[model samples]
Target chain A: MSDRLSISVRDLFIDYEIFEDRRAAIRKRLVQHEGTGRRLVRALKGVSFDVFEGEAVGIIGSNGSGKSTLMAAIAGLLPLTSGDVLVSDEPKLLGVGATLMPAANGYTNIRIGLLALGVSSNEVDMMMPQIAEFTGLGEALDRPFKTYSSGMRARLHFAIATSVHPKILLIDEALAVGDQAFKKQSRGRIDSLLGEAGTLLFVSHSLEQVSSMCSRVLWVEQGRLRADGPSDRVIAKYEAFVG
Target chain B: MVTSPEPSSGLTSVSEALSTREYLTAMWKRREFTIEVPLEQLRSTHQTTLLGNVWHLGNPLLFVAVYYLIFGVIFEVNRGVDHFLLWLTMGIFAFQLTSKTVMGGANSITSNTGMIRAIKFPRALLPISVVISQLLSFGIEMGVLGAMAILAGVGVSRRWLLLPFVLIVHTALNLGGAFIAARLNDTFKDVQQIIPFIFRLLMYLSGVMFPLERLLSSLGEKSWLVPLAELNPLARIIDLYRWVFLGASLTGGHIAVTTAIPFLVLWFGFRFFKAAEWRYGRA
Candidate 1:
């Protein structure tokens, strides 16, 4: 599978079957599976793309333009109503609070977060200091993540997620949180990750970050690809589209 | 990386490193999370409220006492099962797990819109934590129930040793229910609104107030209701507590029936949560 394609998606479509309620759902079964009055909302329509071994891609779109939808479809979080996604790696999604249990301590959250990202116990132990040090929380590292401000929390999240070194990292608006200082620190670490042959699908609003971080950019509009090419041109088109 | 020189690493053996795949390999991994944040919040979430840690044991004890007063003294139910106080207390203690999970789990995901909108991890853990956190409370209530059973006049059976298994099943049932309800409530906010009504219906159907069989023989053969009635995982669990100290019998199809709901709830809940995991943070 690694011979050529790193991630392959073909004509993906995601549709939600909205039934009125459970009672209606049960009653619909009484009559027939059909005519349940279920309606389908197409979140992603015929989205097709590929990311090679070391490509960094940016997915840009207005709210509900299917940017997150496309990323999720590829991450296997949402099953496409009609399409296929094949990847050489198990993509780890690093969205804010995506899988992190907030009630746990930064220490325990790291363990759970690492596990969700597909990391093991021993490795997490080894990576612990590096993540803690990079997060720059110092004694705060020992505190509950909830105690830390949003920026502090994001720093820890960035450190732990990058520590595992995923082959393909799916980031959704995680960068938008945190303060300017946190951003600079996080960006430095993330830059180091991208330098090492990891393919990333970053979904964000900052045009500056998109142009700076991505090798290529894809703009989605109302569940369809509206623009695809170099980050500069795509961002420009996306800017106009958003306007 | 915003600056984007590209990352490159060599030399270190990543194989020896922790892989997320290995972590999620088991559906039920009992290890504590490896983080420094949630623990403080969880502790504070519990402690910041009045009564501190005492509430864990106090709340459930209070609930059991009320039921004991109502069932054992006020109305005076419980035909023949012996040690009516112990029986009523234990049964109420056990049944609350379902009611709590139903009410709590129904909105486990929906209620945490803040978390749902921001984070992503094993969604199952949300419901799992709700149930597990109550373990201490259950332990305290169990002690009170056991002592009461002995005082009320019933012989202890060696077979009463099987109580843990029932507790596990009860936990599983709660986990499963929460899992399914978590996902359903996400799509339908109204699910939370109707929880009290459905629970009331299930309350009578599952026999929380009295021995279900005594109410009517017509209920005996209703195979569909049998699972909820006899093996009522909750009732079976409480009865086991009673049987241990009071010599109650933990028999019948209730266990077998109740068992099925957990596994079904688990399977579907997992799939449903996974299906929506990606969409959660999006607008």
Candidate 2:
């Protein structure tokens, strides 16, 4: 909520190496060269931005525009090719494909997911009831996660991810699958994260949701920050550009 | 109107390698995660099996039995070694432990690719946890080894107490091997396919089924292959276990080689593993 910087991404660049074939990828390891078959796809190019504490910033971009890559970079999940990403705290990323064991039941996943996210075992037990209620899978929680419908899976993931009240939350389109009731509940959770003065970086294609929920917006174009300003201004510019 | 943002003083840039202190501290904090996952997996491993946890005991027993038939009954490969059954049992168990630990560790990171990308925990925990799980299974196999030792007319002696000491050294060696395999497999993936073949060759060279000293003496003491065989840490571990359990006397030189090799491997493997910490998930 204060003016302190939550995240500072300075001249950040991420290069994804594309191997034309499996042999090329394996051979590159032995030879230590790009070889003719190896190509570097720069996912984020000289991108720089600063997010203040308690600010909810929506990163809007078309597919392959580096929205998820930027979020992953900020979460310290991706390897940066050049430049720096400085964060006040380790950001919790709630991607739709967040790490849940498909083979395990929902209850087991809740324990493991929370544990993976660094929640203490004792706290995991205490948080179980609330997480169970929020996800509302009920008896279905006993079945394997792979058996759950995609919507059910997303809901469970969202509930477990929000259970810890992260200091900085990075959500990459995890909310897109939920129904109206689930959305209402998640909206409340987001508001609570905001109430606790937590910083939020959301990557979503839903312009209406982004415009309403975020105070500021960032428009990424082909790995570059094309626009950054108040939500209305940036969204207007983005719409005009697209149209 | 928007103004250009200031470069904040709080910015802390990330480098390729985390400091040793920071990395260790982070690992220590998530120590429970490392410990719990393996325990959970072991519990669920045979939950649906009719024999349940008995398979942990049964599987190794069955494996050792087949090797016992081939090497003990048919080939009489245990001819020179006293208490052949006990000797063969120890060798197979130790060999199995090493192979399992290496193979399991090799797959640890690559197998959990999704989790690594989804969560940002210490990457080292993957291999560390693999070693721990294998150690747990090894503990159970040791009990079966003890039963087999007694059945073969070997009694408990002061030398048996030395089993724990050997175990500690052997564990260090396994941990080191696991670390190396984990890193190698993350990159080459061919490392996994090649591991079984490599271990198969090692099994013969390391004297897992037969007495190396008997073969070495037959080939002449001064033979270069003798020292080469002595250099293998797994052979030394197997010989060390046989010495403690079956009362075989390994030469002073052989004992020295066994003791020295594990520590050396541990020192080298750990540094080699740590140096590649940042590359595990990314690669």
Give the best candidate by TM-score: 2
lDDT (tens digit, per residue) of candidate 2 on A1-243: 677787888888999876668777757767777555667899999998888888999999889999999988888887788988887777888887655566678888898778777788898899999899999889999988879886788788888778888878998998888888888888899998988888999889999989888999999999999999999999999999889
TM-score of 2: 0.93
Docking class of 2: acceptable
Worst 10 residues of 2 chain B by lDDT: B1-10
Each prediction's DockQ against the real complex = 0.13, 0.49
Calculate model 2's interface RMSD in Å. 2.6
TM-score of each: 0.74, 0.93
lDDT of 2 by residue, B1-283 (tens): 2223554565565444687788888788777777777887787778789988888778877877898999898998877778877788788889888999989989988888777877777788888888888888888888877887777778777998888899988988888888889889987878999999999988987888887766677889888887778788888888888898888877444677677777887778778888876667666
Find the candidate with the highest DockQ and give its number.
2
**Over 4 Å off, model 2:** A22-36, B1-8, B14-16, B47-52, B218-224
> Compared with the true structure, what per-residue lDDT tens digits does model 1 show for residues A1-243?
122345666677888666656677777777767565666788888887767767778888888888876766666666467766767666666676543555556776676666645465687788887777777778776666667676666677677667777777888888888777877886776676666666788899888888888869988889988877899998988777667
